[model samples]
Target: MNSEGDLVHGRWLDAVGRDGVQQAVGLLDALSEAHTIRRLELPVHTMLPVVLRQLLLPVMIDALGLPRTRQEWGERFHRGRFSEDERDRLAHYLGPRYGDRFRLFDPQRPFAQVAGLEALNGETKTAAQLVPSVASGNNVPLFSALSEADELLLMPGEAALWLLHVHCWDTASIKTGAVGDPQAKNGKTTGNPTGPLGQLGVVVPTGETLYETLLLNTPIWADGLEPQDRPQWAWDERPAGLGCMPAAQPVWSERSATGLLDLLTFQARRIRLIACETEQGTRVHRAIVSAGDRLAQTPETEPHTAWQHTAKPKKGQPHRRPRRHTSGRAAWQGLGTLLAMTLPVESDGPYTSLLLRQIADLQRGGVLSGRYRLGVETSGLEYGTQSAVVENAIGDDLPLPLRALLAQDDGLREVLLECVDQADQVARALDGLNNDLRRAAGGDPLPRDKGSRPSARFLHGLDATMRRLLAGLRTVDEDDEELLERAQLAWEQCVQMAADREAESLLAAAPPRAVVGRTVKSGDKEFVYRSGKAVGVFRTRLASILTRVAEERSAKGEEAAAA
Candidate 1:
């Protein structure tokens, strides 16, 4: 009836071609027999191919008639007239030798005779003969049948529709090239070299075109059919590690349309949405009825009309108003209380004392029990002071002891002086002990009674005694000038001897300069005081004293000269 119908019919023929015609007929016959014709109101454009392959062909061959072979149609039908110009163009483009390709299918011969069969007259044919008869030998007949059918069925108005269907169906098969070989000139032979059939002049069809056509013609059918599901495609040139965010879901509410719109606008800016549960047993209908009735019963008023219409306050009576101060004060008081509780307790001197106090408080308050004696033997002061000192120095307020030592205060100075003296004495004692042991280990130069080797306990006791002595000395006050001076002098002498011994030891050990450097601070300022600079100051003073003596000598000489 329309171009769409022609397109549908053409596609059906193309789908059936020759091989599928029998199957195509059977499906259509079954539908026809079922009397469900109304349901078959599919667009002819979309239905034709599917009906031909899936319903028409089989029933037609079994119930109606088998398709004719090309040779049976004779030379008149197969050999069509062409212009001289067309022949010349074909010869020029395909080459003169390509004429041989056209000789394969000779439509002049009778197909029934070629197959060694008589024309059908309601007689049954054996499958063996039938199969061999349609074998085609050097020339296939199916492609010619499809081409002929396509020409017969397609009208000028139907050309576009048929092309669209064919294009869509052809795309479904992903066919590779031209439908027919250019070298073939004879109308009798038909084969597509690059069509879906992978041979020249062969037709290929898929059901997609039929489906689309049916949908276009019969829109009502779409109501029952599930919409086709298609995955969205996107090109992401993002780096390998990237990913896309998921789409957000809608949140529904029973608020007024304006209120809902406002909420949606707010939610668009927020990262997450929260759902509030409605009251239990509050039916939506009941809520709507209540709201509508309430609105109807209420009188319309301007803004603040309720306040304006209220009874006037009694004269001379204190006008009662909502108190805003209580809540604000309560909030502020809470904040102050939090700050007070969180502020660190300020404690000076040893943290051990503060810790002990806290422990005692806890025990008395029943927060701690069971004969607990939580001793914190800290070597630093309490937290606040430490925090302040470290923050001032290095953004970390250290404890009092560490701050004192790091800053090299008077206390640290006294301790360091004490350590130096103690270290020197210990070194001297160790040297003496080593020498004695060495002498004993070797045959003594002075004769001595042989006995068991000296007990290691003696050396251990010596070390312990030295440490205790140093510890006591380290606690000594800086005001003990006499003791400090003596210790300092002795330390200097010991240091000189130790340096000499270290040099000799290095030579004896054959230690590298690198080892020596690692063992000592090489910078001049590091040990300038210990390097006899203080001694040099003394020498300079002595020289100054000598100069005074020389001046006195010269004065006496001048007096003698005057006499």
Candidate 2:
């Protein structure tokens, strides 16, 4: 009922019923004239408070045993067997709780001045009164009569007993070496003592006596308390009833402490299912409840059946609902999955989400658009970057076998050839433009028609041809240094050519064209030329021609170098 299905309400009801029964029994026993006994049935849980009292009461009574009263033990002091020193020491140690019945005597007397003084005093003085007065006056008779051994032997037991008594006093004084008696004045002392005796005055004997009592009674008391009929106090003489109490076990309260945790886990799964069902617009609470009951009944054996129960749609359902496609948004989900895969094991949600968003944007913008769609798009980019990194990791002067492997392995070769070919195409295109511009500026004739302009198709074809040649070189198995050198040079030239062509295009389009003539200025310096338009046209045409020538030169150079 308290979310854990425990019968807490039932427990409370039982406790109330038990208390009523106990009160009724008490009233009936009191009113009965004849000797009468009644047995009542009380459930252990309901009777627990009473049981605790029954358990502790005997222990308290047994603990207060045998001295019967503190006065009885004090009266024993007047027997005259103990010397005056012994009497004084005992009184000092035990304090006024025992009263002043005992007294110390002078050592010289050797015997009592009056034999058994109570007998001498006759009716006037009790044994308690006469002995303490006789014993109190001097140190000599006390020290003379008792040997050190006898004194020491008498001490340990009495010390232990006194400690137990002090332990029972809740308000026992703790102040050391104060003169006035503790029991005489509400267990408080006069003043704190500066001396060692003052320090001793504060020393409570409780713990030591408690230890002795526990040692003496533990085994016997433990056995006696084990029987259900025995009072719990039977174990009290064994260190304050500790031995009688049951050892603590794992409890329901401990299990309930983690109740919220278990509930949250169940709720999380339930919420997920609820979200899915609501999204699909299913209304079947009875079915959900029935499935849950079934799950609870055979949780370990029919897990899949329970799952199916939740998944099953209601009867007479429509064949299909209208589907809203969010493929674009779903694509972002794929990107998220990809980014999550690449992330370090320790990476948390925010970093992963941020990276996924960036990747998703890149994919949608066509920046990363290609055959490698979904998760693979991000993966491909990662692979390409990593491959380049691996290649560069191997230095320029790599071993011959490694170089051959790099040049011939289909994957490695493709990567390298693509890089090389791109460089070559760029260089040739730029170089051809720079050369044409120089020629036109030196008064060379320039074609005036659009036919003289570089063809887009031609430039594209040149790029395609270079790509294939580089791809072929990547397939080559032989490791010729000269071939490698030619490849490198070709790649460098291609990059330089591309730059020159771009520069030529910019120069031709710069302002003050007439004053500049057909000449392309390098910096502040300008060379003379014919027409700016003509030079632009001528340079573009030559660049296309030169690109083809550079490719052919690269091929021939590669073949010759290989040979």
Candidate 3:
């Protein structure tokens, strides 16, 4: 089928066809659909046509046990609107084999009362009407949909999928518009969303082999599900705060059929099975990855603002601590810290997860690192409260020597991305320094240094060094070598500071100098007392060494300034 003829439902890929539609339908007849209730949360940039033509439509057809007809498939999976006769026919057809296997749970359904089917107002009050509340949780439509099923494939909303994929499960709100409101007068005049919609959640099965279960059983299915070679999908370690990217958030198209068709045909691609392999005659796996510009990935990040906790002043009251302003950067850091601590740590696999897939692309492009750890210092944790309804279980502490890169320029995402790409070497270099610090400190140093002096020292020095280097590097001129000289001098000063700090630590342990005075040798003069030669040598050498270092740095600074 041509991409132009693809259809979508609930922002999910459905079916694609035109001339080859019948051929695709025939292909479905051969594959037996494992009776699985699979739900999917796809991205806005998901390639609908390919996903439909390659993965989903076949699964749906087989799962429903529908006849191999393009029209029937279209009516159910593609169009999603069915006539009374069609519904009756479908029910009748599947009745013998699967009695009442399919049903919809409407949250708006009225409760059955003792007074027969008749009601006082003859109206069905929605779940919201039954229970009114300002909270998103309270407003959610709570109804039993899959309670009876012991095993069901659960897919989340787009946000939830990204969260799980990235291994970051920060609680957040999803705004969905009001549905079927009689008071809505015009198309755009509908009131704000009813409440915050939450991502679909599933109980994490417990076992020693938990990860294996997750990869195979997760609802996020692709074509060619063959178990081999340690299951292609592997967990990729991403830094904190990359989960909720606003730029690549999925947006479902609300266009007319033709417009949507154009969108599908023009801006879509998918993963196709190329081959399968067995390594060492034991592990087996399918190769389903594609190569091209068509597989370009979209960035995902959590969109959240930093909150400022301020204390209000009152008349005749003691002054309160100032509120901390939360910025976007801080929010991201928090999420990153959470994921770093929580997610599994692994290296090799088939890369089945969407998050893992994206991470691979990012790593290849040098946008993401393969290793990350939590910070030992945090601003968002509450410790010790034996109670119900606990929030933020992980105390707010991060691994010290934090590895975060913020934009030197104003908050422009493009510039920030470029900065990150260019700073890969710098990041690696600093990572080495952090490792050194970690080894020296034994664990995260932030906990021991309650005053954060070491962190402050390292960060300030790093900032100055980077800024100087960048300034010098950015300076462009044929003959002007002044900025470069300045950069070199700045780097030398940084090295000098480190050396001096080390010297100071070593000197602190030295035996205290004795203030002993020696009597001048005697022959004639009787009583001239002088300080010991050892004391004088020690003072003079130390002073000379420090003086030389200072003079050299001063001279270099002056030369650069003059130039």
Please give the range of 10 consecutive residues that has the lowest summed lDDT in model 1.
286-295
Q: By TM-score, rank the candidates, best first.
A: 3, 2, 1
Q: Where's the lowest-lDDT run of ten residues in candidate 3?
A: 228-237
Writing each residue's lDDT as its tens digit, candidate 2 over 3-50 gives: 111111111111112123322222112112001212223331112112
CA lDDT for candidate 3: 0.25
C-alpha TM-scores of all predictions = 0.14, 0.17, 0.21
Q: Per-residue lDDT for 28-140 in model 3, tens only?
A: 21111111212111232112112332232323322333223323322332232334554454344334422221111112210000111112233221221111111122222
Task: Give lDDT tens digits, candidate 1, residues 433-490.
Answer: 3333333233122223333222222233333333333334433444566765555444
**Per-residue error (Å), model 3, residue 272:** 36
lDDT of model 2 at residue 86?
A: 37
Tell me the spans in candidate 2 whose CA falls farther than 4 Å from its real position. 1-463, 480-524, 529-563
lDDT of 2: 0.25
User: Residue 24 error for model 3, in Å?
Assistant: 31
